[model samples]
Target: MGKSGQFIKRWKSLSYDGKVIFLKSAVCLLLIKTGLTLLPFLQFRRLFHRITETSTVKEVSPQQIELTVWAVDTAANLLPFELLCLPRALAAKYLLRKVPSLTLEIGIEVNPAKHFEAHAWVENNGTVIMGKWPESVSYHRLWAWK
Candidate 1:
């Protein structure tokens, strides 16, 4: 069939728990997007911190959570609006409550011609989980949140 039909079939194939996780990720994305639009940067950070702190910790494997986040992000990124790194990293962090080994890292790069740019990514056990770049060496790590 067509792409929409394929997507519907794939979504229908997921277990109930998987569907719940996907919905949670979607909510996280919406919250982050709205916070960025309606609140100051610090205020958005506070909101994110509060949500993450209050979220229930599920007993799931780090790899499983990472995969779920990846799937959600992939689907979300298909939208017309830019989803960016921050929302993706935040969603991954929110889903990986029990797996504290994974951390969210922000990095920056400066180019004389192109100006400055920043990126956020998730990592577990030193391996990049999301937002990996082929030229990772070009960016200087700014800070990380665990």
Candidate 2:
């Protein structure tokens, strides 16, 4: 919790115009890697691989599911797969829902030494609305509130 807290503490919010400028810049950008164009199907592949490796039934928490849904809703008006996560950030800021501030750490196997690691997810009150910076999924974090 300590490290993640510090990372977030150093972050400043994007101003309204800054946010708008960011949005404009994002419009012409690619959200995920081109390889991830198949990500929707890859979720199943990831599920099977995880099951084969650890035998888990796709363990997305209620908070994760809710936020994913919210992300989908918020991204609908935007690019195809480009803005799926932005809505979750906005929702976390003003969704007015009760959710826990949870930190998540998941490791992907492509480049385990450097690429494979953990991520920090943060929820507000009880709902997961945002995540740690850079989405590196490797950094350790601090205690988040619910």
Candidate 3:
């Protein structure tokens, strides 16, 4: 597995302007997300593989957690109308590729009463980035990592 400290260090090396460029130019993220949702995952990963590499961070594969955060933040800035649905499955799959034997559980639920269903995410390693526990709530899970 890649060293966490090393990953963090690499992530920290980006310049302020460089980060803004990637975030602004991440125009294809919406296409990637939608295409992946429709097409075969491996094919989509091929598209995503490009995205994982399209950052200012050097010496790091597209699979690092920091890279993902970078990419997501950038896309959020660019994709104003996009659903930050949080790309949960994509993140999990990325972790699965990078970290071996990573098993995550997503307790997914939706409530139509509130107009949108909510999804609960939990990593097998017990990381609760989205601990809203939305399993019983009604909010559409745009995409989440469990």
Per-residue lDDT of model 1, residues 39-125, tens digit only: 998998887777667434456775577657756585566555778888788778877756756788998875556668898988877
Q: Who wins the lDDT comparison?
A: 1
Per-candidate RMSD vs. true structure? 2.8, 18.1, 10.1
- On residues 55-81, what C-alpha lDDT tens digit does candidate 3 reach at each position? 232343333444544555445444556
**Per-residue lDDT for 51-140 in model 2, tens only?**
324222344466444544333333333444534333333233222222223322222223446754433344534434445344343344
User: Which candidate has the top score in TM-score?
Assistant: 1
Candidate 3 least-lDDT 10 residues: 54-63
C-alpha lDDT of candidate 2 relative to the true structure: 0.38
Task: List the candidate numbers ranked by TM-score, top first.
Answer: 1, 3, 2
Off by over 4 Å in 3: 1-28, 36-64, 86-92, 101-105, 109-116, 120-124, 130-146
In candidate 1, list every pair of residues with a backbone clash.
Answer: none
Worst 10 residues of 2 by lDDT: 91-100
Which has the better TM-score: candidate 1, or candidate 3?
1
